[model samples]
Target chain A: MPEAVPDQFQGFAVDKKENWNRPKLTSYDRKPINAHDVVLKNETCGLCYSDIHTVQANWSPIARDNLVVGHEIVGKVIAVGDKVTEFKIGDRVGIGAASSSCRECNRCKSDNEQYCKTQAATYNSKDVRSDGYVTQGGYSSHSIADELFCFKIPDDLPSKYASPLMCAGITVFSPLIRNLGGADAKGKNVGIIGIGGLGHLALQFANAMGANVVAFSRSSSKKQQALELGAHEFIATGEDKDWAEKYDDYFDLILNCASGVDGLNLEEYLSVLKVDKKFVSVGLPPVEEKFEVSPFTFLKQGASFGSSLLGSKAEVQQMLDIAAKHNVKPMIEEIPISEENCAKALDRCEAGDVRYRFVFTDFDKAFTA
Target chain B: MPEAVPDQFQGFAVDKKENWNRPKLTSYDRKPINAHDVVLKNETCGLCYSDIHTVQANWSPIARDNLVVGHEIVGKVIAVGDKVTEFKIGDRVGIGAASSSCRECNRCKSDNEQYCKTQAATYNSKDVRSDGYVTQGGYSSHSIADELFCFKIPDDLPSKYASPLMCAGITVFSPLIRNLGGADAKGKNVGIIGIGGLGHLALQFANAMGANVVAFSRSSSKKQQALELGAHEFIATGEDKDWAEKYDDYFDLILNCASGVDGLNLEEYLSVLKVDKKFVSVGLPPVEEKFEVSPFTFLKQGASFGSSLLGSKAEVQQMLDIAAKHNVKPMIEEIPISEENCAKALDRCEAGDVRYRFVFTDFDKAFTA
Candidate 1:
């Protein structure tokens, strides 16, 4: 039998923009469960760059006073609404950046719910089904989401390891699978720019997909790590002054996974893509950050510039299955869920101090101990 | 039997950037015929926007003192080099923007020679096989080019019609066929943004490809003409403020054939593309012009922005065959080939005064009448 549900859920919330990093432990009212809703007892949640961006108001001004930001959520279903057929009371599941979408739209019906016009973000976005209820994220004791957005965790995958895959993994995986001929991407040259949370996983996914994976970072510091993580070659872009020239027209697909675009030379990166290929960015810098390229630049190599949002629930499940099969796991540091740790994790992530990712664990201890 | 080849080619050449529109009749030396070279007695040449840009130095300063700047050349082969096997002495042929490319390169071998590093333009660009011989374009009595670059015009297609198809037709057709599931693009919502030379041809090609074609122009003036040119619907973007909203997530493919990006709301156009679709540009504005879009803009709908150069040799042939098969003819105005008419054509094209395209004919009258 599942544990009794709480009327209010507790989590670390940023009450003010000025004190964004220093989140405080607080309780917030949960939305009334809908027919397709499933309530999860939060076990682990990944610390994504998006979380830091949200709290810091880099994308937009903090819309809600008690905005709780965490989307790479992994937990157990404690409750399932009457019409929730996908999940039972104790199913292990995960939810990524998206919480819900109007299921009737063409995009939603076509497995592109992540880009639905009325799609709601996992946190700080208004729940269309509820009145004045802004959706809370998984940086909490419990998370209630439409069962359609929740993906079942593969039994072989650990909850902690599966956390970051919810967002970072699928963000990279979808574009790779879509562009690189899916499961058999053999002999294709794939480049992963900025080996951070997403790039590292992109390297692994591209490699597992049988592509000739190349990892590009600012320096040589992550060279060994990138190779160990599945890159066939490593390019220290900052160290090599002639990297772009040397690798001109090299990549079949390049995934830009850098968290920021400061000092990013988009043209130099674009110069290395083969004709009729694409450079897809899954790591968003800021809402205001624009990618500028001369039309001649794209014309020269017949290249394209595009970005993908988080993958659909179907893609998310496929990603988890692929991850489990290929042993694709994010290098993560486990942190006990607490107000101080959450603040520290955000600070460290903002500072680019984390090796790859951070996952909040010890949820029961943080909430009840 | 074919007529004897002339020692020199005569054409209207732009001697000064300041007097770009006032082209003067001049004689220039042609590159010595190579094994793969073919010489043609020019009959009709299309005045493309590129001709105006080249003479006016909009793309770059005139590198040559006398730049003969027309690429859409259609003529009968008068001379064939020793190794030219594709055509005999009297074959009717057409040559578009590209004149020659290093045939050994992967791009060249793979039918993407238009993007080869050493690809030579039909005019102004340096002939890689020759020493300091700048290629002079058509608008001439006779033209010389690599036979590989010379495509046999379909017997059913008139020389005047085939002239614009060389450059303008293939520019739009390549991208359409490449993106829209070539040969049969039925039921796809395809938008041709701009109803000028390139845009006009794009409409016919997209329609011929069996797409649900929509024409987007600045005003309703071209509504009747656009509808007649195979557009199922015509949208005056300037007249309708809510067109973007109304057609949000609508197009399967959008070909931006607008010659200039002045007041072009890229975001608004991008907003209408369905998820994972592309907005491709075949029109060339000035070289310095840059396309800027926020990452979030592309992320929202999973749309891509890309541009294409002139089509490959294979694509050009395919385009011509398709045009011939479907009667995809460009609406053209015929002008007699002369220094005065060439100047007038350039001035008119620069002012956007031409209806769709201008094809210069009566080559013999201009040179030897």
Candidate 2:
């Protein structure tokens, strides 16, 4: 073990449920590194909507008193356990929403570990493989993850840009690649709803994959920006009353990337899909929120409704490779890692004020204690 | 026009909505034959669960007084319009649920006329292209449909067996062929829910498509029958408490051919699907019923929920060809077509007295009035 690796790690965490937005600087302990574990000194971490949702306890009550929520971690390897062959000291890598899964399951063996029943999230989750320790995330000075979930950061991609791709990038990239025939996606019509953090990256990836991308947003405010981000067409759903009529049966694949589901007209979005196509939602609303559709709506076009979580470890590697190959960069606002800055970023993210994503940097300065 | 073609077709009609179950024999006018019209002398028709649902006003109120309700029609073409090239006089033909569609639309041009907005049902639907005449279905002396919506019965297929294939057959066949890679479905794991009208045919078609078929029924009573009808395995869902646990992530494609949705645990059915696989429903429950699932259920395996209507003309012809090639035959009970016999068949069908399906035959004797 490296002498520089701290016994106690520092991070911004939420201590009180009511004061969720006001994260406080705090110290936490990491689990003992196992044979397959690699310790990462986080260089940058992306502020995701899930981070806010976790602190606010929207999905579930905080499982731990001090919940350090951040999963899109881009860092350099500081130490590796005996059996860790995938990463060595000084290797740049990234970790997304999931940190570990029961590797013995068929799903894990088949490159679908994200759907494994015993999979552990990067933060505020119990690591059953490691003595039931509550896992902390990349907001801390160090993050320890099984080598299976850690992805090598491409040399062409910088840490700040790669941070958001760890979460937002994989969320959209997995579906597009899987559904749109991977490299054979040329000339396919892809519709992306919402032009925020996830949607913005979806546009870049879909375009880079050679799909004709269309951006769907509530207003025309993001039309120019969406186009700049690689969308060939834009549909302002709020302004266009006849949008459904105009684009009826137009899209080959429509991905719902909106952050929330309130007032979402799912039938209208479904109406635009071609026969036998799919409408997959990646942006999750609150856990209580549900999507309802008449059976006839699906029957009308033989269409399907589906959703996806974070990508598999293999898919995460592929996503990073594609990002590097296409030079795909997320529009990120960099914030110095501090208790006050973390609180401000959470507030802005909740308000949808950020232009795109927020990546926290200066981890060394913030964690110095 | 031939001398055999009647100026007015006679059928069993439901006059009053309250007395929907008791239909009376009545005569009705046929739309003036257009360029693409094919007039058929009715021979046999399948009594589908949809027939009972329609006649009993389960889907909608009796659209018109004396509405005739039947769709799976098989007969000999007695007359053809000037532009009808697909069928000639005395050619055997069949018409499923759809009677006609706006042939100029993209959906129609692409062989998906069943999904066209202007598509007309065979029974109690207004034909927009034919002076808005109410269309009567196969429980009649004769029937008329556009050549585009009519298909030629294969030489080797008999009318009694081919009747159900028109509606019940295409309804299940389209989804299987579309989702399971058509002829390339060899060795794929396919699950069929329910063992009644649609399901029985689904089992045969999926098996003939070379899939490893599994049948799911409420009780063990149908286990032997399901196996005999080409299922490699049978699951008695009502008796098996751990069915979902036993078959988790087991299926590549699952078709919900169950007649009703009374106590369907969709999450359980979804749990058995492999990651990125589909659960498609061809059965139409009451219009008021909706399938609800939490978004997490779909995220768990990237599984999809979808539904399909009756197939297109091309797909119907392909289904018939496959039936002929594979010697696929539906299990059916024959009933003579009469006001009394029709009512009896509907009653028996509602009570689940029939083994699988009922085909109304002896049309010449029953419609002689």
Candidate 3:
């Protein structure tokens, strides 16, 4: 271990008293990395919709008190434990949603570790090996991860573009890869619903994946942006009353990225799916939000509706590699990782204000002296 | 054309005035077979739940004023039109749910004519080519069909067993074959919900298809019956409240054959499906029946809920072939296809009184000498 490695680091956290909606900046002690763990000097971390869910106490109770929330992290390995061989100091690495999964489990062995029973996320989750400390994410200068979960960021991918790829990039790409049986998804009709952080990247990934990408938004305002993001065509459901019927049996896959589909005619959205096709939704609306579906909808086209979690470690690596190869530049607005800026970013995210995604940078000023 | 084949055939018919509940015996003039059509001398027609639906007007409004309802028809081919090369006189033939589909459509070309837009059932529908007259079914002594839809019953499968296979057998087998990627479905955990006509046959086909079969009924009384029908295990959902949790992520495919899912805890049934698995409902409960689905249910297992129509011509033959290879015998109660007997059978089916299925026989005594 390097003596220069700081004993303490600054992080933006949420405690029981100062909850998710209003998180606070607090200094936390750096833990000793295990033989399998690597300590990273995080250069960029993305502010995702899931971060808002943590701040707002959306799904489950916060996995830890004073949890620093950010899963889309890109960094340089500052220190590696004695047993670590894959990475060394100054090696650029990245960690997505999953920090650790029970590698011995069947899911992990099958490369589906994202659904592992005892899986732990980067934030708001307890580390699989340690019981004393809850996992904290990359809303800090330094982040620690088990080497198995940390992916080597290819040199071609910039820190800014690579950060959001951890979440939005992987979420969209996993389903396409799963449905098409691999990343060689040629001649597939990929319909992306909503054009936010996840949706914009979905369009780009689907395009680069050799699929014909179509963008669907509530309003026509994002039409130009969607086409610019590699969507071959754009359809605004709000603008076209008969859009669903018109494009019936058109798409082989529909990746829904919109939040809160409470009033959305989900079956109608499903109309675009061809026979035996998949309509996968990765967006996490309120856990209680109802998605109305009729048996007729499923019977008519012999289609399926599915929900996907974040990508597995292998998938994350593949998505990043693909992004790097295809020059998949996500439209991201960079902000300094500060209490005031994070608070403003959280507020803006809830208001659907970001162009695509918000990447928190300048970690040196935010944490390290 | 055989002059011995009478132009007038007696059948239990429903008119606009008499309605579904009060079908009466009526004699109707049979039309001449077209170039690619065959005339069947109906020997036995299975009284299916779909027959009840048609006779009782359970689904859509009757497509015919004088509808003679019976789709699960097993009989001898009496006459064939000029272009019909497949069948000669006395060849055993069967007509499943769909009797005709637009032969030129993509669905027909791909052996998915069951989903063809212009497909028509054997009864309660207007014929595709002969639109003026109603397409009467095998409740009469004779029924005519487009050669494209009629399948030759293999000599090994008995007429009694083969009758129900046209409807219930194919309904259940289609989804399993579809999900499993074909009829050679070995080692898959196949769940059959409801132990009636379709469910029992599903159990047999799944077992014969080399799958581990699990039968789900409302009561424990069906346990022995299910085992007798080749089920590896039986679950009485009514008796076991915790069955869903106990068998969570259990089945790769669930064939729901129950007439109604109105009161069933559908989520529990869905919980039994594994990741990327499927739960297919083939029963047409009611047009107004509403299904409540939680997005979490779909999200958790990455499973699908779908409804299936009757099998296509190819699937029906495949199902019968599988059945013949396995000596799959359906527990059927034979009844005469007289007006009074047909009425009694419909009521019994509604009351869930049949052992598994009822094949209406004595077509000669009921129709003509």
Q: Which candidate number would show the highest DockQ if scored against the true structure?
A: 1
Clashing pairs in 3: A20-A55, A21-A55
lDDT of 2 by residue, A156-262 (tens): 78899999999999999999988987755797999999999899999999998899999999999999999999999999989998999988878889999998777
Lowest summed lDDT window (length 10), candidate 3 chain A: A16-25
Worst 10 residues of 1 chain A by lDDT: A288-297
Q: How close to the true structure is residue B286 of candidate 3, measured as C-alpha lDDT? A: 67
Q: Which of the numbered candidates is closest to the native, going by highest lDDT?
A: 1
Residue A207 in model 1: lDDT = 88
Better of 1 and 3 by TM-score: 1
Candidate 3 lDDT at A155 equals 89
Every model: Cα RMSD to truth = 1.4, 2.0, 2.8
> Which lDDT tens digits does candidate 1 get at residues B232-317?
99999989998898898889999999887767888888899999989898788887677777777788988899988888889888
- What DockQ results do all the predictions give, each relative to the true complex? 0.78, 0.70, 0.53
Write one digit per residue (lDDT tens) for candidate 2, span B142-259: 8999998898998778999999999999999998988887766897999999999999999999999999999999899999999988999999988998988988878999999987
Kindly indicate the candidate among 1 and 2 with the higher TM-score. Answer: 1
Task: Rank the candidate models, highest DockQ first.
Answer: 1, 2, 3
Worst 10 residues of 3 chain B by lDDT: B14-23
